[model samples]
Target: MNMKEANKKAVEIILKGQPTLVGIGKALDVIPGMKEDIFLHAGPPITWERMSGPLKGAIIGGLIYEGKATNQAEAEKIAESNGIKFAPCHHHDTVGPMAGVVTPSMPVFIMENKTFGNKSYCTLNEGLGKVLRYGAFSDEVIDRLKWMEKTLAPVLKEGLKIYGGEMNIKNLIAQALLMGDEGHNRNKGGTSLFIREIAPSLIRSSFDRESVAKVIEFIHSNDHFFLNLTMPAAKCIIQAAEGIKGCSILTTMARNGTDFGIRVSSMPDKWFVGKAQDVDGLYFPGYSLKDANPDIGDSVITETAGFGGFAMAAAPAIVQFVGGTPKDAIRMTLEMYEICEGENDTFKIPALNFKGSPTGIDLAKIIETGILPSINTGIAHKDPGIGQVGAGLVKPPRNCFEEAFEEFVNSMEKELSNE
Candidate 1:
């Protein structure tokens, strides 16, 4: 098929994909291809030697969590010793936010694409600051991680089971848009909606009253509770559109704090990478731009599925946190339309008068328009243990899109020649 036909086919699959939250489980048991000693990270692949501070910090945290080390120094030595294996979460049908480290025992949300019978996985969101995702691994961080695995994961698993079949994630995301959640950095609406849906089963669950209350409190307290759900949902949607030959639709956009990467539907496994850029926005009182780590996270999956940054018009209030005006949010959404192939029929933006959010990023459009996809992201601190310093907007490196477009052209030319 020609590029046009290929793109049409890709968009068709993307729009029709249905991702539902199936259950929660350990990474090794739930995520496909997850194995002992293998940790899935964010963005393109990189070794321990080349990893950035936050990435290294996360690996050190993972080592501690896995019982391989008792202290940060030992963890660092273990990582450098080649005893650990690092791979991108995308390679294992898993996605993680920020540092995006998924060790064997970490609990993950499993999403199933009911439309295509495919599954995707993402680790649970650990609130915001002092979390492993941002490369912080203090005693508090390790304790929180343990609590999530022991108490939170089991309760969610039981709650999901008691709730019966898979929960429709797309529906939650659509309703969330109306309630002012773009399904990424701002998921307060989505988190509330999720609690509303699961409260009934959680209340009646066999777990004791205190346990139920703790689980509910945890869910209610963390506004980003919906982010993990959204990531896997986006993964399922984009995975459905994978392998459409000659399609220029971008299926993946992620960062590991050091490098940013993108993958097109036609070249599903090949990553077009560029240096991860620092975010430009608001920072905490004690932190400045100098203290911030570069943009990081698999949360970009939300934009890949046509919401998040693309649906910013629906969440104008987000500007207060991310350092922008309401008009800037709307303008960003409007600008995104130029680089996308179509509007997502399912994920509508209420602020835009029920118009579908721009969906299916097309490399050709980006190259032609010279506009990069804007991302709403959390900024980790550059040093380990400092955690989140800020939240802001960032754009994928231009060279990433340019290189993807060039690769697409080469692939198309090769296909034509074979014909």
Candidate 2:
């Protein structure tokens, strides 16, 4: 098939994907290829020597959580000594936000692409502030992690079972867009929709009233609770489009706080990387642009699946948190259309007159339009343990897309020569 035919086939596969929240389980139990000493991180793979501050901090936290080290010093020693293995979550059919660290014992949300039978995994969101995902490994962070593993995971697991089976994540995301969530940095609507679906099951389960209430309260208090759910859902959607030979569709976009990376459908496992860019937007008090780390997270998976930044037009209020005018948000969504191959049929945006959000990012179009994919992301503190400093907009470096396009052209030329 020609490149254009291959691209159309890739887009068709992505559009037909149906991502569902199948269940929740421990990372070791649910994620394929997870091992006791293996720690999965965000973005493309990098070594301890080259890891950015936030990524390093997260690794230390993971070591402590896994009981491989007793303290930060010991954790650092283990990390530096090669006692632990580091791999990107993407390498293992998983994704994590920010530092995106996942240890064996951590609870992960499980999503399955009903159309393709592929499953994706992502850890539960830690509910903001001083969490390990942002490079914070304080006692509070550790305690919260423990509570999630011991308390939250079980409750949610039971709740899913009680509700009969997998929840359709794509449907929730569709309703969320109408309710004002773009399913990325702003997930208030999505969280509420999720709670609504699961609350009844929690109440009917064997758990006591107080325990159920506590679980509901925890979810209610965290607006981004749906983020973890949506992330794996997005992964399932994008992975469904994978392995389309000769297609130039972008299947992944992620950051490791130090570098931004992209993977194309045609290229499969090959990662095209560029330096991570600093976010340009509002900051919390006492923080400035200098205090912010470069954009980081596996959350960009949401955009790769075609909602997050691409649905900015659907959630105008998101600009208040991410720093942009409503017009800018709409413009970003409209501009994305120039580079994407199609619109998502299931994940529609209400504000765009019920139009579908732009989907299927095309590398050739990106190079042609000179437009990088826009991302709305959380800004971590430059120093480990300082937590989130701000939220804002960033774009993957132009060089990454350009490089992928060049590789695509080379492969296509070789194919033609063989013909």
For model 1, what is the error of residue 2's alpha carbon versus the real structure, in angstroms, after optimal superposition? 2.3
Q: lDDT tens digits, residues 236-290, model 2?
A: 9999888787898999999998889999998889999999998988898999999
State the weakest 10-residue window (summed lDDT) of model 2: 346-355
lDDT of each: 0.90, 0.90
Q: Per-residue lDDT for 168-195 in model 1, tens only?
A: 9999998999988899989999999899
In Å, residue 417's CA in model 2 sits off its true spot by: 1.9
For all predicted structures, in order, the TM-scores are: 0.99, 0.98
RMSD of each: 0.9, 1.0
